[model samples]
Target: MLIPALCFVVMITAVMQTAVVPLMPDIATQLGVSPNAVGWIVTANLLTATVCTPLLGRLADRRGPRRVLLCILGVVLVGSLLCVAWDSLPVLVAGRALQGMSFALFPIGVAVLRSALGPHRLTAALGIMSGTMSVGGGAGMIAAGLLYRDGDDYRRVFWLLVVLAVIATALAWFVVPDSPGSGTSSGADFWGVVGLAVGLSALLLALAQGGTWGWVSAPTIGCVVAGALVLAVWYRHERRFDAPMVTPALLTARAVAPAHLAAFLVGIAMFVQFLAIAMFVQVAPEQAGYGFGASVLETSLLYLLPGQVVGITAAGVSGLLVRKFSADRVLMAACAVGVCGFAFVGFAHDRPWQVIVAVAVLNIFVSVAYGALPAMLVEHVAPHDTGVANGINAIARTFGSSLASALVGMLLATITIAGTDIPSERAFVAAFAIGGVTALIAGFTAAASRA
Candidate 1:
């Protein structure tokens, strides 16, 4: 019951992150904001989550996971309500920022499962919870497409999120038991938090805005250089602090470091595939030379949802494999599968079925990789450090995904038609090729980790 409850909470967070994707155009038109401005709705959420996930994870470790979990769900509920009640662009962005905090719930929930479940059940539970992210994200996009199919009532989507969040909150409050490491004497390292927050914000801001601001522009270069210096200082500060946000020891551990690297690389491949496929499926056949020209709902149902379903099932299977075999072997196999998927899409996506098959294969492997990563990390870290460890891993993956977004944007923007906004097929192929190679590298990394 506790495991399923935690998975539910994770799924809800995943849903909230993606539910707005299909509605971005409608949201822009309704709020009288430019599409470029509306893109900040997603950016603000990603930036907020990147800054907050590790901080919240530390808090959960020091405080109780139950307490922290409830608080996060509460914030999500409030964010959903705010979106439902207000129509202004600023209000929506603010609400989305709050919603972003929900990303912390994944690491916190993983920590709770680590504490609550015995070793026999732990790996499977983590697998299910991790898989829920893909499932929920796809489900959320599908739900949003259905809800907003006829008109632009985006509030309806928020209302559904509000309801789902309330249920998750109730389940978490009732089902999750408190662990033994509740009362720590040390307070959160405030200066470390500030440093990390400032550094990551500056860095992600640069990446997120680079497409609009010109990659070599003053703001972009300044933010990147400043972010790097600030993070260097923050690393030193963390080493000196008593209760650092992320301990250097945990990060550098052999068991943990490989998993983190694999997570980041796999994340890059996963997100690049996601963005590239979404765009490819939606490209007008006449303009792109070969596409289905799918609508939002059709793309959700036909392209995204099926892969998510495969991923969910594959996660369970991967968990079983981990118990029977080894996490390193399973992770290597998963990455190999991902490489095949990306390679297939890279070379052969002229037909809709080809795209669907490639995505489903990719998602299955991605889900397996996601399941294996936490299991590997948990083996090295102390039980109490689970939240922060997983938090850092999540941060790595987020950073990779953000980088993928920037890369995809650059690729598509460069290959656009002169008179229109349509991107050439070469852009999609280039993105897929990059994704395939990244997955190949990740596979090698995972295999080498076994040594």
Candidate 2:
């Protein structure tokens, strides 16, 4: 009962990331802007989410997640209403930033559960929680696509979001027990907070603007370098400070460091597969065979396998696997299967059903590992570190995603098969090839971890 309820709340956290895809063309059309700026629709939310996650995670550790959850829920409510009421693109982007603030809710909820849920339920609960990030993303995309069949559709999506928030806010306020150790932390880690904000801001700004600025342009390179320097300085400073954002010791832990590395690798590899696989099955082009000119709604159905299903499944499976198998082994096995799924795309040129099979396998891997990672990290560190540690993972995910988007765009530009230009199907194949190789490395890293 508690598990199901938590999954719903976490789902709400990721709603913005995927839910706006179908509406993008409409939004850009209405706002009178180029579709390329459409990337901001995602980057804006991601940037804010990446920056705010640690702060919210840590705040939950201090004040109880109920308060934090309610606060973020309120922010989303405002964001949704603002988007609906305002006609300006800049205003919509601002509203989107508020939506990003809610991203921390999922990870913070995980920390809350870890501190209180019975040992028996903890493993499975964590898995479901982790998988929700992807599951929520996929679910949001489907929901948005289904709702936005016309102009009136965008309004319907927000009204639905509003209702979900109202329900989730109620549940968080009432159903979950108070988080233990909610008052464990002291006042804010000021410098730690500032450095993380400045660093992430610079980095995300660079990535989001690189498409416009040219990746190697002076402004773009400066933004990237400044971000890197800020991050490095923050790590060193946190190592020496009293109440560090993420304890330097945890970063160095044999169990914990591998988990961080594994998370980053997964972030890089998984997102590329997601974009490529989605593109492969739907794009109508001359370079590919059996090009299905599916609508946004139709294309989404083709890939609907276990990603959304895994939001609920990972928790149950994690408990079973952790009981009999090492989390390390289970994580390895899941990632190995994900790699195979990605590899399967190379052979799925004309077959759309085969792409579904691939997504299911990849989702299973993501579910198991996502569940195991947070629990594993918490095992190695004090309770307070969960917020910032998870924050780092969030940052890595954003970085990985930004890199994947850029690389995929570049691949589409360069890779060609015959004298005839290669279709999007082949570009997808190239991207998946990279994902499979990266996930294979991730599998080895997870399996070899000291945990």
Candidate 3:
């Protein structure tokens, strides 16, 4: 009951992030906003999630996770209703921002799981929880495709979100039990939180908008420099504080640092598969030199869904592997398989079924690493640090995803087919090549980790 409740929470959060993607153009048309403005729907939500995740994780550490979980659920539920009630763009974006806080639910739930479960049961449980992230993302895309097929009205999606949030909140209230040592008296680092918020916001904003705003533009460059300097100061502040929000020592520890590195690289490779493959499969062959001319529904059902299913299965397999061997080894082998998968996609994506196989192959490492990275970190850290530690790791993966998006945008834009806006086949091959190399590097990093 406990694990199922938490997995439901994880799925809902993931669905909230992904479900709006296919509806963005319709949302823009209905709201009378430019394409750039419509992008703010996603940007605002991600930025809010980036800033709020660590803060909420810290709060969960002090208060009980169940309490924090319910509060976030309440907020997300309200956000969903707000979207349903409002037709204004600003109001809708605001609602989405509130929904973004759901990102923290994963780490906070992880804290609860760690406290409640024993060593024997923890790895398999974490694997299932990790699998939900991918499952929820796939579900979101499929749901959006099936519902509101050609409409400016996306309220139906939010109504469904509202219902799911209600169910999850109810289940959590009953199933998630209180854990010991939750009511810690230590105060949060006000300056640390502020610094992280400011620094990450500036940095992620730059990454998120770099393609649209020209990567070398003054605003992008300025944000990059400012974010770096602020983070540098924040690092020093954390090191000197009596009880920092994140312990610098723990971050730098050999056992934990590798998990962060592997997560970042895996994030980049995973996004390449997700974003690049989606675009490649959807481009009409008549309009472009390549691509299957698949609709959004076909892309989601035939291509992306298989990978997601494989990802969930891979998570379970990874858990069993971790039980027999070590998390580090499992991560290493998973990444190695990922390299082969990416290479296969690079050379052989002419057929639709080939793309599906590629999706499944790439997800093997992506899902395994998602499970193994946190499991590794959880084993190394104390219970009190669980939420913030995982929060930071989540931030790393988010950062990597942002960078990957920018990179893929650049790659696909570099060489379009003739006068059409469609990307050439060469661009996709290059993207997959990059993914393969990144996975190779990630594998080596995991293998070298002392953990």
Candidate 4:
């Protein structure tokens, strides 16, 4: 029950993060905003998540995860309600920002599982929880498509999310047991929080908006430089300051650093598969010289859904593989699959079956990485540090995904079909090749790591 409950929590957060992707155009139309303005719906949520996840994770560590988890679910529920209650862009973005706080649920849930589950049970529990991320991503896509297929009212989707949030809140309340606090820290480092918030927000904003701002544009370059400087200063401050929010030692621990690096690279590979593949399958062959001409619903059901299903199964298998070999070994093997998967798709996307198989194999890589990376990091950290450590790891993954989104957008837009705005086949090939190379690098890094 506990495992299932936590899995639900994770699944819903993942769902919330991705469900709005297909509806961006619809949202833009209804809200009477430019496509650029609608991008903020996702950007706001991501920015909020990047800033708040570690902070919320710290709160969970100090206040007990169960209480904090409930609070997060409550916030998500309110966010959904707010979305339903208003049609304005500002209001919806505000709601999404609140919903973004749910990203902390993954770290906090990891902390709870560590405290509640035995060593033998923890691996499988975590794997299932991790797998739900993919499942939820697919589910969210499907749900949005299905709900909107009948009508133009996107509010219907938020209403469903509201219901799901309510159920998740109730289930979490009843099933999740309370864990004791760390009892070591009585107060937070105010300056540390401010620095992290500003630095991460600036960096994430730059990444999220880079494609729109033009990579070399003044605003993008300024943000990158400013963010880097602030974060560098923050790191130096934390290293020397007593009672820092996150210790320098923990951040750079040999056993943990590799996991974070692997997470970032794997995340980039995962989103490349998602964004590039989704676009490739949906491109009209007559216009782009390749593609299946898939509708939104068809794409979700046939391409994305199959991969997500395989990802869920692969996640469970990852736990078993960890017991037999090691997490690093599983990661290496998974990334090998990704490298092959991306290569195959790049060369053989002419057939629908090839695309389906390619997506499934790539998702296997994502699920296995998601399952194993946390185990690698959590095993090396103290129980009390689990939330913050995993929170940071989650942020690394998010940052990677954001970067991937921008890069993929740039690549796909680099070479358009003759007169149409559709991306040419060559652009997709380049994107796939980049994804494969990223996976290879990630795998090599994992193999080299001591952990």
Among these predictions, the greatest lDDT belongs to 4
- RMSD to native for every prediction? 1.5, 2.5, 1.5, 1.3
lDDT of 4 by residue, 374-426 (tens): 88877788888889899998999899889899989998787777887778789
**Model 1: residues >4 Å from true position, as ranges?**
186-188, 418-420
Residue-wise C-alpha lDDT for candidate 3, range 233-293, written one tens digit per residue: 9999999998787778656788788888888898888878888898899888887768988
Worst 10 residues of 4 by lDDT: 181-190
Cα shift from native, residue 239, model 3 (Å): 0.7
Clashing pairs in 3: none
Residue 259 miss distance in model 2 (angstroms)? 0.8
lDDT for 10 in candidate 1 is 89
Better of 1 and 4 by lDDT: 4
TM-score of predicted structure 3: 0.97
> Which scores greater on TM-score, model 2 or model 3?
3
The positional error of residue 347 in candidate 4, measured at the CA in angstroms, is: 0.9
Comparing 1 with 2 on lDDT, the higher-scoring candidate is: 1
Q: Looking at model 2, which ten-residue stretch has the lowest summed lDDT?
A: 303-312
TM-score of each: 0.97, 0.92, 0.97, 0.97
Count: clashes, candidate 2: 2
lDDT of 1 by residue, 33-101 (tens): 898899898889989898999888878987878888899999989988888888898899998899999
Highest-scoring model, TM-score: 4
